[model samples]
Target: MASPRFLLLFTTLSLTVSSAISGSVVEDLANLQPPSDFNTTIMKNCQHNPSLRYCNSSSMDLKEIFKFTIVASHLCNESKNPNCVHSFDHIDLRNRPKMAPLYLSYSFFWKYCPLTVLSIDLSNISLKGSFPKEVICCDQIQALDLSLNGLTGEFPIESFAPLTNLTFLNLSYNYFSESKISDSQFFKRFNDSSFIHSGILPSDRNYTIKAILLLVGFPISVILMAVCFGWLCFQRPDYLPRMFQRKHKFTPSMLRAATNGFSRKNQMVRSEGVEIYKGTLRDSTQVRIEIYRGCISREKRKEFVEECKVLVELCHKNLVQVLGWCRTRNQRAIVTEWTDGETIEMWLSGSAPPWKQRLKILIGVVDGMRYLQENWPEVVYDLRINSVLLADNHEPILSRFQVGDQYSNNKKIHKFGIFLLEIITNRRSQEFERGEAGLIEHVRDNYPENLHKVIDARMKLPENMFDQAKHGIELGLMCTDQSISKHPSLNQISHMINKVYESCLELAPQNHKRSHGDGVVGKDSSNGESRL
Candidate 1:
């Protein structure tokens, strides 16, 4: 057995080797194809269609790590002007036997390609159901053509509002329920062509008199059926959940009083153009209020309400619960359960936390993140040290009140990697020397060989725990890996982190023995063997 001091490092190294071997075996068993292979398959599938020649693998670098960009805009259009978009030329997968449903194949294709798909021209692919929330995470998507598809449910114009870069969208010939689309500036960019086939009759189906007679539909009976169907669809459920309904929806005046008339004394954070104030409700419930600065515009207010509806539905122990919201003609604020602990960023600015505390926080973060991915289809764009609040008991809670841009698990994984590095190094990426670049970039560049250099200077990791810390760093790298296929699932990551923690627990006995001046015994080293 290795000495207790080196056991963690040895275990980490061994686990890495085992993981690689097992990963390859799993990949083979699942018959999963690499990104390059998937790209080639896509190209071959589109070969017969001349318009889809742009689907060529050369247009995208599937092997490029950590960067996403579209290189060929002209492939979709013949116009000489670079900005001109005639049509999103490559997404027509209609009648293709090998091509899977969009939802089933979404993550597979998304991760394989280096470029964020700018224009999706899926005009004839018989897609159905509510808009696939997955596609919205592609922040760069500019044009979407879902015309002639069988899409249903409420028109998700509000969901698309965050895609600031979106320029053109066509949802014609699809089954979409009527909703207020013109209320937002985001929807205003889309014209009448976007709503062509309300998916309702006469564009939908024409019921003939003969067919109606065969179904025993008299004029009065037909009218009653139509009325019943409309009522059923409209009364199915509340857009906002019943649990979120509150009788004590605080008015702006009440909030003002609770927050000391919006005084600076109540302010908790005033960064990134966001102001958060700490306050107590009349019932003495401690709360945090996030106030959005400019007066709520008519369009913006509608979007906020819709977003709140979704936010209120989420419930997780690791997440800061959103209690209620206040919106008046002049102001908008979202209220959440308050915490006495300082921001993780603030805490990190001091001495490094104990290894156990750090591990606990990391586990909490992973749990919260996994919940977000499973429940919320959107990207966690606001994950950062400032967003993580530590309680008096040092428990970590992830918080987000406002709806922002679309982000995906891939982006979250990358940010989580940076967060891990920050916790370990006690330095912000922006604070790095100009030549060194971001934290992940610098660490990745120096990893395995010079990793010790990146550890927080103040953190004297016990020799036994050093390998555990290194193991965590490796997990961070895996999370931030450029190759999407290599990235561990949320559950896998959570398990790995917990395993490292278990190893720490296993070392406790040996450390105690050494501290008591008990000469190291073979049994002591054996007791220190990693439980993982």
Candidate 2:
């Protein structure tokens, strides 16, 4: 409405004001001050390095500085000196534009203060190459943000074990769709948001159906599925297979009563914001209730529900059963059948079991895995001793922990091999001879003849059982082979194990034949002995 001259003046003023505001923001970021409690001693050491141009401690925490703006003066090149890393407790450069090469960042990180960076944010940096193992060198890292990059090759997820303090992680929108992570708990703190654009994370049911239709040429089944899914979404939302379901609606009062007012004394395992409580139902039935704390995001809640739905649908004696799920005012809860028996790891820590017992447990785990691989869309991404719960009868039940297809079946086979070696050597995968990287390599290096040295000293094997142990070791070695093509299928392994068991039974004394369950033909039940 103003005159042309006045309008022109106003437009010019607006542009000038915007430029000034932007410059102010940049200057403020450049002159950011470090916190009072920041380790100045370390800062002095870093300041000694001349190559680092933008090394400054900051009071700004992770949430405050979600993203960083790079100015023309900003310089973060590779440094040879180890003291040239950023002195700040948190460094967030997410969605950076034309940023410095990742290798430069890595070199800087590796050279100076690699372990000092507590939090990192480098998403959308157009990062190329496989995720470097150097990132794992940040032993004190709590929150890592490496989403939306051009990262390629298999992600060495096992390397993350050293970063025990990691709390928040984001690896979405990257080339991690096909990459495998062996630990299920590693993904528990994160959600589908972290795994977006990756098949390893759960997807929307509607989108998944559409994807299937697209692949199968839009068949009639697609239409049928769409109609059914629509109906289920509106009428029976709980029946849908996808995440976000309410299995049982128990009141907060009922839960509190079951868990003795959620007492700390009833706590089983506490990690992150999740608390597991041992409870007893009104009918005196024992149960383990997992309560997700208030800090859990909606995405994490959905993932928990989705995982529970999968567990509920799976019916296997060797797999733990999911009883129900509940949501209250502040927390989400999942109820699972409680087993009083010790974990396989705990059992192994005490005394080495006989070959027959160990083999039986191994077969149970393999059977559960076979069932899931055949019936479910997921695989056991994290299979280990802690996940194997030994029942009162010494039956091994696989815990409910699944990951997407990013990890191949070959990886699971490799883990099975490791499990075999653990049983044979009576040593953990983490514990190995000096200079050895992994138990697999150690076993392969001294096999067939020198295996006796690594074999459990507690084992007083009968003559016939030695052959069974040797066969197991051979199978283990085959599964652990570096090449995926060389590994045997679960079916083949199952058949071989059956053959071994039958041969061992045939060698038992004829008088030992009895109506023993679990394929064990023996007369003795008391004191766990074979009576002839």
lDDT of 2 by residue, 1-532 (tens): 1122221112222232234334443363445442332334224433454232224433523212211212211222111122222223445566663544533353433423333357777787788887856556556789888887877776666788777888887776666545444455667766545665544444434444555566686677788998987776654554456474445444455567788998988888899878898988656878888877685667876776676667667778888877777764468887778998998998887867766678788888889889988998474545778668999988888765654576678887877878777877777876766422378777777787886776775765554466578788889888887865768989999888878877766755542333233443344667866532
Model 1 spans > 4 angstroms off = 1-248, 271-273, 379-381, 433-437, 483-485, 516-532
Structural similarity to truth (TM-score) of each candidate: 0.49, 0.47
| Residue pairs in collision within model 2 | 82-111, 82-112
The clash tally of candidate 2 reads 2
| Model 1 weakest lDDT span, ten residues long | 65-74
lDDT of 1 by residue, 1-532 (tens): 1232221112222232233332332242244223434455334434533222134445554332111111122112221223212222233343432332622343433433223246655566667787766566555677766777778887666677677877787776777875653454554576544555554233223323344464676777888977865553333212225564343255675677778888999997897647889997766888999887677679988887777766777688788888777777767788888888888999888757777778888898899888877777653435678779898777788887456546666667777887887787776877766521467777777787887787775655656677787887888777777766656778888998899888878886766666565333333356665321
TM-score of 1: 0.49
| Candidate 2: RMSD to truth | 33.9
Best by lDDT: 2
Each candidate's clash count: 2, 2
Q: What is the lDDT of residue 213 in candidate 2?
A: 65
Task: Mark the regions of model 2 whose C-alpha exceeds 4 Å error after superposition.
Answer: 1-252, 294-296, 328-330, 379-381, 433-437, 510-532
